[model samples]
Target: MSKTINIGLVPFSCVKLAEADFKDRAAVYVVLCMKDNNEWTVLDAGQSCEVNASADAHPRNAMWKTHCPAGNIWIGTYPMPTAGYSKADRFAMERKLRRQYKPPCGKR
Candidate 1:
């Protein structure tokens, strides 16, 4: 079963896997790092029309790696189909998560 986490009250599916594991769909993506104590830390968050593509080309990929080991990184997604939610809605969700987490790599 997939794990779920709440980012500012919105539930998101999370996995300790790669971007390729996600479908090519519209969603808000959260990058997290599993700390040595087993807690998770938000590394970055964003919205994308095609999550897989966005993740693959994310500008903060190197920054994320620098903060956590590759094996400890997790990807969280809150899928929002275009038919149901607009781009603005997705962006709003992403903003909410960023505000709540204030991920270090998300500077600016």
Candidate 2:
């Protein structure tokens, strides 16, 4: 069966990938909880679940395991990272954000 785990301390977090295997280089995802506001369910991939093992020809769309031995989990989502071409270009988006928002220098 599949397994899952809870990340410690971090309220809500994520790693946005503009280029992924499923989308046309325009997707955003959060692999961890950083806000602790929106609730999420058990992840389908991790150290406990062997989702990656099923990646053999027409495999499941998601990964379920990590290279590490810890009890971490993995998941994927669609329709995120904003909804524009700038969002797809991470560097350009960040630059635009900074220029438009103009946050305090040295911290973004």
lDDT (Cα, tens digit) per residue for candidate 1, span 20-88: 477799998888887777688898888889887446457787888888875578788988999999999
User: Residue pairs in steric clash, candidate 2?
Assistant: 11-33, 11-34, 11-35, 12-33, 12-34, 12-35, 13-34, 45-64, 45-74, 46-64
RMSD of each: 2.4, 12.8
Candidates in order have lDDT scores of 0.79, 0.29
Model 1 deviation from the true structure expressed as Cα RMSD, one decimal place: 2.4
Residues 36-103 of candidate 2 have per-residue lDDT tens digits of 44344322221211112222221322232232123233334323234443443544433443444342
Provide TM-scores for the models: 0.82, 0.23
Q: In model 1, where is the ten-residue run with the lowest total lDDT?
A: 14-23
Model 2 C-alpha lDDT versus the unseen true structure: 0.29
Tell me the number of clashing residue pairs for each predicted model. 0, 10
Off by over 4 Å in 2: 1-21, 33-69, 80-85, 88-108
Steric clash count of candidate 1: 0
Model 2 lDDT, residue 97, Cα:
37
